[model samples]
Target: MTFFQILAVVLTATAFFAYLNYRFLRLPMVIGVMVLALATSLIVIGLDGFGLSLADGAARLIAEIDFDDTLLHAMLGPLLFAGALFVNLDDLLAQKWTILLFATVGVALSILLVGLMLFHLAGALGLDIPWTWCLVFGALISPTDPIAVLGILRKLGVSKRLETKFTGESLFNDGVGVVAFLILLEIVAGGDAGAIHVASLFVVEVGGGVALGLVLGLAVYWLLKRVDNYQVEILLSLALITGGYAVSEMLHLSAPIFAVVSGLLIGNVGRRYAMSEHSREHLDTFWELVDETLNALLFVLIGVEVLVLNYPTGALPLGVSAIVVVLLARFVGIGFLVGLLRARRRFSPHSVTILTWGGLRGGISVALALSLPPNPWRDYLVTITYIVVSFSIIAQGLTIGPLIARANADSSNPTSD
Candidate 1:
């Protein structure tokens, strides 16, 4: 199929499912689209079982599009930028320590815990996954997807403080998580880089990306400061996102990190000092639409992707066990961060639980899993990642509304450290 043909099919599917969701399912738009697509995929599979060729055709169509390249190289930069663009700079700064801990140390902790648990779990299940590959899974799944988390949180009307923490951590941790994933992937590829070398690579990728974003952001801010035309300003912002991301990739820097930093700068600094009222409104509307459209399509793609994944027969139990492992690892990671922060600041009751359950994995995890090199365990990893992401987005996502409500009620009586 041609690119436009594929695009047409995806958009058509997205729209149909979205309407179905709006009319009957009443689930969150992204989640609803995914659920419907997944159902359609299963139907296709069942038809194939009865000697129809629909499943093969569906899988072939999905396989025509490279999931990893589309997401990691193209969609992710803009998506991350859009999410970061709306974050309130002041609120994010206020929660800097908490965000930092969660995005950095907290992510590392989750990776470690999840990797260890999965390694042992695989052994118990007689799966032949190596410890390193288990860590690869950890790296991919550790970060809460900013797109998924922000989308759900926007609908929940949660506390600004809690919302900020969730949004801020997700935006930043996504970049950090990708960096961790790359590093682990390198080790798995038998790269002979030492500990110090790996540390240096991290600094260069992360630090260089931040530096590049700051430069691009300030340059755009300078231009926007002198302009009053909302159209031109909007165009300039587009250039900043697309050009900045492309340049970061060319320079071998972290495109995700660069996008986030640039987004924060533009969303906060540019909005305040650079853009006029008219310009700000237009820019916000444009990016919000972009975020929504991309998110819907991405989730639909994720759901349909199951059609292409090779799910081994004996891997079902391991995949199910992985879901529990991921949730427990999330709880432990968030609990530790919240507990430590409680030393210096009070937190709402059940903050840990809310954060844990609210950490919805989405397309990024799927993309990372898809990007894995050809290995004995690649298919198994992909299967496990898809199952975990589906549950995280659907099951945990559907239930988080009540968790947020409970957290809000408990916030009034926050316990002091």
Candidate 2:
């Protein structure tokens, strides 16, 4: 009944399913646990719909779970930080240009395209939503999920250079995507603010976010150097996720960016100075455990939280339409941008293909959909977003390995990493 007790029960159940999947199923841990949880919850719901014995108790219990808030608020910070921490700092820095363009420019294109397409489609369906609302959806969904992609990428045996580009872009892209979402919100909420002011606001949100992240990262790194206790150091990094996220959010800065900067600083800049040999080993083990544990909880939350959602039956068409528009926008954005990059010497055609397939949507999309204001259509939006996110994370995340293998097969030498 109490909050902490509920969390303990949820986490215990999630871990049990995750272990089962990891040992026997050989499925990607997140997808496996999520699918299992989803099926089980649906079974309970189906029984309730038919008035089966005990359905009431089961359905009520599942309905108490909140998928949206759990992912967006509690799990996302640590998940993104863990993903960013594992990335090779050198490779990320090398393709910094491509990452910036794809993350920043590519996101803008996807948002504008999806918004306009959805706006028109909604009108045809006799739905009258403001363009601002559609743009809000676009911002929320534009970020390619770093946690999901990197999980697959770790299993991807692509060239190191190519892998770095994909991993780096995916990590920063989420940060860029979230910033885009906030910008769209400002436009919706900023009734009296002019265009020039909005542009200025964008700069401050992004620039200020990056600057704040760097400063916080350095400050943490300096504090870390004076300590040699691995347990204590790991706790500091954990604090960076929980405390750092809380502070950044309070200051209206980007929590996702702040976590990434702090993680990367410890992983790269402070790797030598801040950690002793014993501390390094413990730190790595500590975070890997954190990463996997949170990942398990995230997928389980994604699956069971659907039970609590209140999707409207009225806007199913609009919600479905948004899914189609986003899929098309992704194809166009990835195809055009990556193609243009390849043509101008950014990456090879093969490399571009893998990156395109690698744009996996997961927790962030659902979180954004959940973050939406409750309107008549919000229910439809959340349900549809969940559908799309489930497909992307499970279907795409599962198959990306084969794509990477095929793409890398022709090369004489490749990393089996």
> Least lDDT summed over 10 consecutive residues: which range in candidate 1?
408-417
Deviation of model 1 at 201, angstroms: 0.9
- The best candidate by lDDT is 1
lDDT of 1: 0.89
**Local distance difference test, each candidate:** 0.89, 0.74
Per-residue lDDT tens digits of candidate 1, residues 291-339?
9899999999999998998988657788888999999999998898888
Task: In angstroms, give how far residue 208 of model 2 lies from its true place.
Answer: 2.1
Provide the TM-score for each candidate, comma-separated: 0.96, 0.90
**TM-score attained by model 2:** 0.90
Q: What would the per-residue lDDT of candidate 2 be over residues 1-417, giving only the tens digit for each residue?
A: 677877888888898888888788878787889888888778877776676755556546655656657776687788778777777688778777777788878888988988888788878887776788788777777777645556566665455666676667667777777777767766676653587876776677667667777887788798898988888888888887888788877887777777777778778876667888888888888788888888888788788766776656546666666667877887788778776676554455465456656677777888788777656667766776777777777777777787767767765443322
